[model samples]
Target: ERGLLCALALSREQFVTPGHALVLRLVRLSAEATAPHVEPALLAQKPLLDRHGNAPVYVAQNLLEQLAARFEFSASDDEFQAYRKCLRPRSLDENAPRPLVGRAIELLQFKAVIEATQECQDGHVVYVRGMAGIGKTRLVSEFLEM
Candidate 1:
């Protein structure tokens, strides 16, 4: 009952319409269990939901199967562990430095250009045009990071 109400609210907030790609992705994810009890709600809205699509019915059926699979005992412990890991989000190191090749000289040139631009009079614009694949973006990012 509570889960059904929550599901209704979630669907409304997230715009979870029938036939949307999001429904398929949500069904496949390990966090499928975390979704509210939406079966009853979906059934109630079957007429309107199914008017333009039958995908919601199929997605709901697949979700039920996945939920049932969670309760079943696994034959292989390794496989089960792998499946669990897929559900967990990967962590990233924020302290890690950005990956950039040799650009120290270019950065210095860019800094000099910026200083020169600041000293320029009114209506003067400094354009840093260069060939593609040059370290223009990298130099700009490095300058901003400082």
Candidate 2:
């Protein structure tokens, strides 16, 4: 069937394996996290998507959707693309030598660092100056979501 073929193609794509695994894990984490068509039968099928020189694809939830409505932000596809383009990691393929705090990591104590230290801003770009391993960029990046 056409649907099956699409699923097959998706399963063959990169991140499908890790995503499938994450889905399995999420089955217990949150009901809303499951993909629309994620079923046990599908899980029974091949979960390990063949890695064919393709990288993982991450789809981030728009946490700022409500904020966008409150303020002025683009809800259109084009606007979303532009916002994402700005936040995407440069040279993501280049692995970091040290294991830094990945954006996906859950609630951490360093979150309070933002609260502990306060800086006045005039609603403009401000650089977070810091030393190595201080998580300055990561702090800004956490808000990026994806």
Candidate 3:
């Protein structure tokens, strides 16, 4: 009964609905009956339960705190400095758009293949294979512009 109450309360906190609130109330009543007798004053003093007797917000808060503490990371200054030393900085104009050159014929061929595929219902795969920095990306960029 306690577990069921807890599950319902957590669900209610995540996605509130009248149905969940109703079920939670029913479960809480059942849980109260099954629980060992305790004074009303003492029950009210319990930190986990709220005025309505549901602890969903408290439980969720504690769960998140525990998870954050468990996964918290703190790197030392020396470690951070060492990690930074291995990084490569990019040039200011590395991503600047440049006009494609000397690949007009390849670009036209790529466009023709793409147009041919559009006319058919079947799927087609196009592979642009070339050595590194051989203008494959540039050709594709130019083709897309057309």
Q: Give the TM-scores of the predictions, in the order they appear.
A: 0.26, 0.19, 0.33
Report the Cα lDDT for residue 87, model 2: 19
Report the C-alpha displacement of residue 7, candidate 2, in angstroms.
22
Which 10-residue span in candidate 2 carries the lowest summed lDDT?
79-88
As for TM-score, the candidate ahead, 1 or 3, is: 3
Model 2 residue runs over 4 Å out of place are 1-51, 63-88, 91-132, 135-146
lDDT of 2 by residue, 25-110 (tens): 11245756755543333433424464343322222234333222222322333422322111122343444443434543432543
Better of 2 and 3 by TM-score: 3
Instruction: Report the candidate with higher TM-score, 1 versus 2.
Output: 1
lDDT of 1 by residue, 1-146 (tens): 12323443445455565533122214344754575655444443444423342222112332334433222222322412212111211244655564555777767776777677778843444466789977677678787785
Question: Per-prediction RMSD in angstroms?
Answer: 16.3, 14.4, 20.9
lDDT of 2 at 48: 43
Candidate structures ordered by TM-score, highest first: 3, 1, 2
